[model samples]
Target: MAIYHFEAKMISRGTGRSVVAAAAYASCSKIYNDYDGMMHDYTRKHGCVYSEIFLPSNAPPEWQDRTELWNAVEAAEKAKDSRLARELIVALPVEIGLDEWKAILKDFISKQCVNKGMCADVSIHDTDGHNPHAHILLTMRPIDDKGKWQAKTQKEYLCKRGDEERGFTAAEFKTAQADGWEKQYQYKVDKKKLYMTPTEAEQQGYERVSKNPKSTRYGRQNPICAEWNSEEQVLRWRKAWEGVTNKALEQNSIDARVDCRSFKECGIDEQPTIHEGVSAHIIEQRGGVSERCEMNRQIKADNALLLEIKKQIKKLSAIVVDKVKKTVLDFANTLENLRNRYIFNRYEITQNENISTELKQYNTTIDVTVQRYNGIVQQLDNKITELKKMKAEQKHLNPIHIFRHKELTEHIDKTEKEIKKLQNLKSAFLDKMSCKSEKDIPQY
Candidate 1:
């Protein structure tokens, strides 16, 4: 099955993570971090299927090299708590070929990161056939048209409108005289074998210019509008990976598709099972029973129970339908026969005063028939409700179990519909029985 798994994290200086070391491990190569003057060599590491750097069109061409690109990022960020890179760990569909996986990763990076002025370094790893995944390292800062790093945040001065002391600092406001903390500047100019200040030059009618400086209270620094540091943006990126992976699967004519939605969001009632990671899978393959393997065994058992419940529901539904049909037919026939008998014997009964007894007997028979019908209806209804409750319980099982029992789910749905129709028919029949005239009795 094609599973969906995408995790994102930050490589930050505050956490003591080196982007160069991350890159070395992902690409299985040696790289030097100019920021710390340390060599990150992982040449002995294996299972690196592909690795490449993708950049925006305006970025430097040399940045395509892993060492140069990350080194430049390291040099650009100067703060001790600066974020070095954004890392995305996504699982690839092992059912697809290596080339297809690479193509999918490329498409995802090109649209989600590179097009947004961020450079992406992608690496695909498939050490064993069971575990195939990719690691993407993305630059957090935007690049300008000149291929230079742009500050992730910029300071903005806030000024009050229509105030005499607008933009004045707190200290400047307190020390202001009657003039209200205004700026003053002096400029000297040398012309015609004489030196003159800006005021003197202006008095002489010479072209002179003075500078005006504005005051501002403590400036506030905010992140650039284009930065992807929010939870919402992370969700969008994860969804984008799902789309890319599904598209690749479709292109390769694979039946499987990946989804990034939660079980509730997907309209699935089942709880998702814990992921059996590569290590657990390897352990189980070697004839070792790991915890995950045991969980999987229990999941299989739950699935079997789910299927059995579905089968029981179907069987019980058929039996209820047969019983209801027979009861309705028998009731209708008895009502018809009684109506005919009463009409035929009406002439003889009119001579006697015992016609009331015959009518009472007829009512008694009708009452008995109704009781039997109601009993069957109540029993079947209880069984139907039981089946519904069982189906609801299945929702709390593992999602893998639900996915595996799709056919059983459909069967449950169909059985429920049939039970609903049976209930409606029974109600309609009972309504007809309550009619005042014998001719109104419903025919089954």
Candidate 2:
């Protein structure tokens, strides 16, 4: 099985539209989002499973930089974009079983996509079948008519903290954050059930959420650590996230590979020729030639069989004729013998003065011989007539009599022409898919 992995990013300003288009063209990959910002995220490679789906540009038209994006998101809380702030999530079904994987993603973001001003575009990759995945870039800010932002899942964001240097001592840390005051961070069995508001912590007589398991007895960290900028942490988080996602998929009996990448995993650098678009066009021509070659192979076998059958039929006909000829000769011998016996019987009858027993016996024998000879002649004639008819039919059906080897030769010629045409077509497709420059990478 090939790896069921996909890479994606939130489009940023730096994503050049031309580059994105070029990538799509070279990889035969699909393009989902046309917005400038979303394109940026893809080229910069800020996408992965954890941050799989990304937010669209929330920055003002003139605004630039991540800070502007944050500001735009903030302003959208009060007043949203008039034009539906469109964001999309694109994916390729290559490794993840395009059909089911896309379905899962659609269901996961169904509510998000259906919301006013929000839309999701899901399409199959029609390229060389290298990275058959999806590209999803959704909006971070809400639309004007959707009402004020209620900030769903925003609470999860607030629980995070700065790096370890900014981290306060155990006592001070508990006092610093609201959850710390509630002892949510403390390692205690029952403390997990307790809730702590920032002000409530000071009034309730709880100290900083103790990190020591002996104190609060609940040692739990926030799910999304506040720091995503650290490269090492990001790598570990990505690995863990992928492992968990893959494990879950396995548990549910879902596949973990894509068809496109399987060939590469098996060391097939060449892409399948039956793909859609230009690649398909090229292969069709080439395949036509290959098909003709295979057809010609069958033609050769058929011709050979026909020739062999004709030869066997001829040999059988000759044997039948020889047997009929011998029957004719036997009929002649019987007729001559009967004539001679009849003559002898007549003489004996003439010479007999008393009862001619010998003559009578001879006469009876001659009659039987004549009758038997007649029957043999009739049967031979019937067989000869039948053999002649069979020979005529065989000649009519035989290739040598009808079209002969010429017909088969003509067929081969026509097929060869067709094969030539297909070869030309294959060549055309290859030219189209060929890499033109150093950056225009070829995808199998």
- Per lDDT, the best of the predicted structures is 1
What's model 2's lDDT at 400? 50
How many clashes in each structure? 1, 36
> CA lDDT, every prediction?
0.74, 0.41
* Model 1 stretches astray by more than 4 angstroms: 162-227, 275-444
TM-score top scorer? 1
Looking at candidate 1, what is the lDDT of residue 247? Answer: 92
The residue-level lDDT of candidate 1 at 97 comes to: 86
Residue lDDT tens for model 2, 244-342: 445446655777623323456667533333213334345457653233233343445444544554564455456656587775565456556655655
**Candidate 1 residues 341-388, lDDT tens each?**
545554443444355557558878777766666675776687688667
What TM-score does prediction 2 earn?
0.23
